[model samples]
Target: MFGGPYPWSLYCGQWSILPPAPKGNYLKDKVVVITGATSGVGLEASKQFADASPEQLIFAVRSVEAGEKLLGQIRKAHPNLQDKVMYLDLTDLQNIKDFSEAIKVFGRVDILINNAGINPNFDEGPYKSTKDGYERVFQTNVLSPFLTTLLLLPLLRKSSDPKVIFTGSDVHHIAPSDLIETALQNGQSIISAYNDEGKYHNPTRYYESKLLLQILSRNLIKTLPDITTINVNPGLAMTNLGRDFNLSLSPSGIVGILWFVANARSASKAARNLTSAAA
Candidate 1:
């Protein structure tokens, strides 16, 4: 079910259509922090986690208003849930540090789900760089998350069973290794290669970024021996990650169609895997 014809076999199979998260207070007394919780799998994962009844569920989001709205909806459904939304702009390094510092009030975070990501349509124009001078995709998808995880290591270690979940992708396997090798051979860092506008490619940039994220997460485990750091592919789910793609005869639009087709699961259903990982 997991491996076969590209996305179709995975989409048609049972992996995409997951059962609802089992009802229980498995997360009782635990504190969970999730990024990108206002939409996509992160939004659904928040709801599912609420059902499991954690002591506190904090959502690290860029938009406090949107996070609050989602928190209200979840609270309305599960009145007993204790949740709050905090601002986290992945594009800015200082912002991520400030967000981590604010999280110190919670004392410890049992599970950290790095679920927020972006896949910009490179066809739109030249790649943009973050204020930190890194490519937007690389910053948002790889660097930011890595930095956040590092900053939160102290708080995470306080948990008896601390775990970090990185939302990875199957597409990572197809990342442009030629560029990566060429960059490394020239003494250019991966970040440098990504920032080079001359080498950026549509869609594949996202794929390559995911690959880098996966690699980083694996290495992170060595630094965090006690913490259960994992990277999980939520499979292809319809999410705002493809918000930039518009349907048309254009290359990006065609990729968007494939994205829609491959994403056989709803965000809610796909989130089961994430919540399950926390369990």
Candidate 2:
């Protein structure tokens, strides 16, 4: 093996000897929901979750079409996993409510992964408001997951050792103020707010989202004693989540090679973390 990345030990071709899947049957018997499931990290996590016989895997995506497409492909690849896609445009309040309602039919949720995000559009990235008028990243990355988690809390409680996992990042260490200001819309720049740009710093949006998420998870952990909450960065995931996520931080090509080299863990690692969270 390679020496591995700077921050995380995870890397390509590395094997995790974490015992066989789990006592549960293929994760299909358990209820697992992953937001942003249409692509990127969410998709990878979903694919891994499919390996276990969980009772249900709910793929929450803003686009019904994309959700359906992902479902088709996942189904074709893993016929045993009967995952259903639902419309959850987190920026839209009603959409979030509807998503919660639709999942009500499932009755219980054993695992929940809050992992959707959006980089601000370059032209007016930072200063833009979502359809619900909240800051885009805050609404999509933070609020959406926050609200979705709330709606599913009851269902989570019904199960034993119900788990909630939030995807975190190292970027949160910088620009904590921008994250708070963006949440309040205190004249945050469109680019800086969306991409985490700064007169001295650049590409803060992804980091800021993670900061808020870390804080949110810490605080929420206090309130829910029964529900276990854990946040993981998963090293450098290869999803379209960061680095050029907004107008800034767009490092040129060879990202796969670099990411694979630098603490770059596959979506399977993140998904594996989720599996541990469930246990």
Candidate 3:
């Protein structure tokens, strides 16, 4: 072991490794469905899957403009993916039903990425929405995904390797508990319970939602006993999430820093991982 024999630090790169999925070997033929695929991490995931050349690439987006814009980009870049677009408004229960029905035509949904979510009414919180009668955030971030997954079970179960991934955050791990039953009150949202702006505005509910995501993932893994469920955190990345934050970055820039130093790997990478997990 001569010290001069090797200069390890000379070319050291960030050490990141994805557990090899022996199943990842078979993605070219798999049909994948990605929710919230128009922008942010969802868009990145799509970019990655474009190369894998899956049999079909279905993008579920809230806005046609966003979906169409992403479609043009992906097509221009890959030119080989059999991509299709569908309208998906997670806040609307009917929309979920519609999207689910539309997806059944595929007959097989090997991978389901519950990545689309919204963080809003920060001044109030999800517990205060009348649309679906659910917290705006809870509906989009949690229940919508919940219902969508339930609806797709028939199709996903058809795949040899069916998996569902709920993108979670560290915040979820740090929320006050009891949120479990609160979020699942007869389909409609219950904002009346938490009225203190301080209580709801704090990261509690957001984290609670994520915490529930993990719990759901675990419960589903056991309840379904036929599918693998995983929750992943993308770490801090400079995503356009601030567009939703509504906070002024000019002051402390903590959000800006989090958005900066954390590194936002392209949306394609997120898509790729979902593809990789499915593969």
Best by lDDT: 1
Compared with the true structure, what per-residue lDDT tens digits does model 3 show for residues 1-279?
A: 001122232112112444432333265777888888876777777767666778888888878888888889988977877888899988799989988888888889988888887654233333456376766666777778889999999998899888888776645545566543554664534444433333455334565667667777778878998888877765433456545454545545455455345444444443445555555
Model 2: what TM-score? 0.75
* Candidate 2 deviant stretches above 4 angstroms: 1-28, 121-126, 178-202, 242-263
Clashing pairs in model 3?
A: 23-279, 24-279, 44-267, 44-268, 45-267, 45-271, 126-135, 127-191, 133-189, 134-189
For candidate 1, list the clashing residue pairs, or say none.
none
Query: Which candidate should be chosen as best, given TM-score against the real structure?
Result: 1
List residue ranges in candidate 1 displaced over 4 A: 1-20, 122-124, 249-259
TM-score of each: 0.90, 0.75, 0.78
User: What's each prediction's clash count?
Assistant: 0, 22, 10
For candidate 3, the lDDT comes to 0.67
RMSD of each: 3.2, 5.9, 8.1
What would the TM-score be for candidate 3 when compared with the true structure? Answer: 0.78
Least well predicted 10-residue stretch by lDDT in candidate 3? 1-10
- lDDT head-to-head 1 vs 3, winner: 1
Candidate 3 lDDT score at position 108: 91
